[model samples]
Target: MSNHEDDVVSALKRGADGYLLKDMEPEDLLKALHQAAAGQMVLSETLTPILAASLRENRPSADRDIQQLTPRERDILKLIAQGLPNKLIARRLTITESTVKVHVKHLLKKMKLKSRVEAAVWVLQGKNG
Candidate 1:
């Protein structure tokens, strides 16, 4: 709704459900609210193009790829992409939590990504191959 790149990016990164403008009709706002309550993501129609462009701009350059990850680091990256926290990843992988953290740190560095969120997005974008 604000159509500001920084605000849109920040809200999405922080897990905002929807970013509707205040200028929308009351009925539309109510519909968005109900859609959110029903567990759907509600982004304003106007935001899609900008949001897509922002995502593209933040990604690692073409030469920097996920292929640099070690085999174990790749496993951890996949788990991170699945939204599993370190503790759960450790449990699922039969490793220590600290070990998982170490792998995560390594994987993030190798992928040239900043956070688990970025890694997850990268994976979802089919960049993990």
Candidate 2:
């Protein structure tokens, strides 16, 4: 039912496995449900291009802008890309959560990214290099 584009993007960023507009016909909705149950991502027709554009825009070029990151920052970025929460990342790195937050903030700024989800996509898609 949500028509807000930002809401749709945010939901996906937060790990929503499927997204469908409320206006979708019943048959399409059922098909989407089945697709979701089968471990496929489902998106409304209108949303597909939006998601694609977001991913394309967020993807980095081959210059390895990650070179701007320190070794530790790179490590934190990798964990963030893996979808680790700040607390868990801190525990894994033996650093304080606050410190992890600081690193995340710095890395996000350094990479010119708006959120951890973008960073995750970049890393997972091998765009960080």
Best TM-score among the predictions, by candidate number: 1
- Give all TM-scores, in the order shown: 0.62, 0.61
Per-residue lDDT of candidate 2, residues 1-129 (tens digit): 685767877887676645789899999999988866754446687875666567776544553599999998999998876556777788899999899889988997888765665666567766775
| Model 2, position 12: C-alpha lDDT score | 72
How many pairs of residues collide in each model?
0, 0
Which regions of candidate 2 deviate over 4 angstroms? 1-7, 10-52, 58-64
Clashing pairs in 2: none
lDDT of the candidates, in the order given: 0.72, 0.74
- What is candidate 1's lDDT per residue for 53-105, written digit by digit as tens? 77688764585576787888888888776656677788888999899889887
Q: Provide the lDDT at 19 for model 2.
A: 70
Model 2 lDDT-worst window of ten: 55-64
